[model samples]
Target: MPGPAPRVVFLGLDGATEAVLRPAFERGWMPNLEALWDRSATGTLWSSEPMVTPVAWTSFLTGCNPPTHGIHEFHAIDPAARTIIPNHAGRIRVPTLWDAISESGREVVSLGLPMTYPPPDVRGIVVAGSDAPGLQWAFAQCPEFGEEIFRDLPGYSHKVLWKRRPRTLDELRSVSLRNREVFRAQAGAAERADARCDWSAMMVHFHNLDGIQHRLWPYLDLDETAAHQPEWTAEVVACLRELDEAVGRLLELASRRDAAVIALSDHGFGPCRALVDVNGLLCRAGLQRRLPYGTRLSYRLSRIRDRFDRWKRRRSPEGTSRRGPRSIEGEVGCDWSRTAAFAPFGQLCGSIFLNEDLVSGSSAAGRTIGEIIDALRAAEDPDTGLPLFADAFDVAERYNLDPAAEGLPDVLAPSTDGYQAMAKWAPFSRSLLRPDPNLPATHRYDGVIAIDAPGVSPDTRLDAELPDVAPTALALLGQAVPEFMEGRILDEAFDRDEASIGTAATGGPGIRPARRPIG
Candidate 1:
C-alpha cells in the first residue's frame, strides 16, 4: 500500500484581515483561529495589485500573475472591441494544484471557491461557489456524482444564502448559526469524500467576515456618525466569533497527525474612506474627454442607485412599482470599435490587455496603441498634479504576456495604493474624492496564512509578494516548480528533518486551451 497520503485542507476566509482578527481575538471573538495561529506558523499574507478577490485568488491557485494566467482584472476589455467581458468568464491558462493533485491520482473537494466555474475535470468533486446561482444544481448535471450532492442542497442553499444576510444584532447571531450549519454539511461531505478517495485536499471559502466589514466598517468609528450606529459593534464581534466556531468544526474533520491543514485569505478588509474616480480624473487631465455637456449626472448616479432598485425588484414581483425606463448617456471620446484595453476590476479599478489581430506585426493599429499607453502614462491628476497611476508595466517586463499575443495590450496600468481606475464616460465628481474621516475600521494589506503538520516552519514571517504563495504550496506538496513560474519556492517553510516528498513530475491532468474551430 502507498505510504499514508498527506491530507491537505485549505480554509479560505474571504477578506479576512489580521487587523480585525487580532483585536477580535483579544476580545475573545475568534479563540479557535487565535489558537491555530499560536500553534501554526502564522503571518500576514500579501496580495497582488488591485487587491481584489478574483485576481489574488487566481494567482493563489495557479501560482502565476494575471498576465500569465490571462485574468488581468475582474473585467477585461477586448482590445479591438473595447467591450466589457465578465471577469469570471475566462479559464485559467496555467495549471492549478487541483489539476496537479488529480493527475497524481489524488481526490480533491472544492466548495464555494470562485473561478471554478465550468468546473475542471478533476479526480474528485468540485462544486462551484454560491456566487453562481444554482451552482450545486449545475454541478449535479456533471457526469461525476450525478445527483448525489444536489439531492442534499435545495434544503441547504436557503439557509446558506439568505439566513446569513445579516441586518440586525439578532440577525447577525442567526447568520452565524446558519453559516455553521452550511459548513457542517460541507465539511461532512468533504470528510466522507476523503475517506473514500486515495489522497484528498478539500477547500472551503467562508464569506461571513467580509459581509460584516463591508456594511459595518463605515459606522464602527464613533468619529464618523454619519455611517455609524450603536448596534453595529456587537454584530461585528459576533461575526468573528461565528467564524471561530466554523474553524473548530473544520479542524475536527481532519485532526490526523500527518494531515496538513491551512487557513488562508486572499486579502484583508478595511474601511473605504477614500474613493478615487479614475475616469473622472482622466477627463480633467484631457486624456479622456467627458460625455457631451448635456449628459445628465443621473447616468452616474444610476450605476449606484440601480443596484438597490434591482435588488428590491428581484425580491419583489417584476412590475409592482412605477419603474422607469433606464437611460443611457453618450460617450465623449470613446470609440467603441477601435478602443482596445479595458479596466474590469470590480469597478474599483481597471487594467488593459490588447487584442490578437490588432497588435501583431507592423499594423499601424499596434503603433497607435503604444502611443495611447504613453499618453495615459504621461497624463497627470488635475487636482494634485500627480501621475494618474502608480506605474505602468510592460507586458513582457511584469507579466507572462503571450509570446504570440502581439495584439494584446502592451501596457498594464495598475493604480496607486488607494486610487483605482474606472472608464465610465461621465463628468467627474470631487464629492467622490472626499475620504471618510469617520471610518472606524480601515482596509490593510495583512492577510492570513496558517499551516500545521511536520516539516513545516513552526512560526515564520512570509513575504507578501503575490508570487510566493503558489511556490510555497508546491514546495509543500512535493511538486517541482516549473521555470515558467517566476516566483521562488519557499524552501524555508520546511524542516530538514522531515523527509522531502517525492518530486516525480506528474504533469497536470485537466483541460487545456481548446483549439479555435477551423472553418
Candidate 2:
C-alpha cells in the first residue's frame, strides 16, 4: 500500500515572540504550546528588515521578499502612480504556499492570513482576515474562489476583540478572555471543515497575544511596586495561558496520523509608548514642505466632509459611523510635497519615496535620495535620545523596480521603539515625541516561537533564509520546491528517516527556478 500523503497545519500567532513565551511557558502559562515544543524541534524564526506583520507573513507565505511580493509595509507603493496602496487583497506577485498546493490538486483553507484581502483561488475554504475596506470587493475580483464563502466570514478587521474599545485595565482583561473564546470558535469551525474534506492545508492566525503585549509590556517590570498587580504580571500570564488552552483544543481536533502541526509567529513584539512622527522630523530635515495658508488641497478639504457627516448623522441615518459621535472622514488626499512620511500602525516608521516632478531637474536624484535615507538611518534624536529610526531600506533588493510603478517610496522607515512616523493631514501631530507621563502602555519587539511535531528536528534554527517556510512545508508534504523560489528549503528541520519527497526542478538550498509572476 502507498504511504499516506502528509497533511499540513500552520498556526500563526501575530507578534508572538520568544521573550514573552519563554517566561510564560516556564510558569506553565502555555501548556499545550509547551507540549508542542517538547515534541518538536524549534528555533527562532527571524524576519526581514522592518519586521512587521504584512511583510513578514507575506514573505513566509509567498516565499518572496517585499519587493517581489510587492508588500513592504502594511501599505504598498505604486511607483508610477506615486501612490501609497494598502496591502489589501493578494496584491503579491508571487504564488503563495496554498496556491502551490491547490495547483497540485490538494485542498487548503486559509483564515486571517495578512495581505489575503482578496482571497486567492485556492482549492478549499478561505476567510480573509485584516479589515480592508474592499475585502469583499477584492474577493469578488477573483472569479475562482466562491464569493459566498468570503461573504460568510467577517470582513478583514485587524483585531475584532482588542480594538472593540480603547485600552482600559478592565477592557484589557475582558479582551483577553473574549479573544481566547473567539479563537476557540474560529478554530473549531476550521477543524470541522477539515474533518469533512478529503485533503487539506489550513492556516489560522491569532492577534491577541500581540495586542496584550502591546498594552501590558511597560507594566511588566518584575521589581516594580505594582508588580503584584495581576494586570501587571499575573494578568499577562493568564492571557497567554488562555491562548495555550485554545491551542490544546485545536490539537484535540487534529488527527494523530502523519499530520504536520506547526505553530509560529510573524515576528516578536516589544514596547512602544509615544509615536514618533517621522514626517515632522523629515520636515526638519528639509524633506517635506508645509501647507501654505489659503491653499486648497484634496486632503485639506476635510471641513466640508466633517460638516456633511455631522449634518447627516443628526438624522441617525442607516449608514453612518457604527459608533455614534462627531463623524470623521475615512481618508483624505494630500499635497505630497507638504508630507514627508506617515506612520500607519505602530510599525511603519517612514516613507522616503522621491517626487519625480519635484526633483526632475536634480542630477542623479534617485542616488541623492538614497544618500539622504542612509543619513537619516544613522541619525539620532537630540533630546530624548533614540535612533532617528530603527531600520531603513530600498526596494531594489527584491522588487524589480518597474519604471511604470508609480508612487513607490524610495525608502521605508521603522522608528526606534516608542515612536511612529505620521503623514500630513494628521490633525494633532508633534514635531518630536514628548514624555507622556501618564500613559502606561508600551510596545515590544520580542515574541514567542514553539514548534511541536514529529517531522521537526530538535535544536534547529530556520532563520538562515526567511523564505524557507513554504519550501519546508512542501518538503513535509513530499512535494518538490520549485526553482525561481528565492528562499532556501529548510532541510535541517526534516530528518533523514523521512522518505524523500519528489524533488522540484529547483529544490534545495540557494536554488532559483523559472517561475511566472503572480498577477
Error of 2 at 433 (Å): 2.6
Best by TM-score: 2
Q: Name model 1 segments beyond 4 Å from true.
A: 1-5, 79-82, 130-133, 137-199, 218-230, 293-346, 352-389, 394-397, 400-411, 423-445, 464-467, 480-483, 497-519
Provide the lDDT at 217 for model 1.
61
lDDT of 1 by residue, 403-465 (tens): 224333355565554444554422435443544333223334567777665555666665444
Model 1 lowest lDDT segment of ten: 510-519
Candidate 2 lDDT tens digits, 67-115: 6676666665445333344565456778888888899998887766666
lDDT of 2 at 274: 59
Which stretch of 10 consecutive residues in model 2 shows the poorest summed lDDT? 321-330
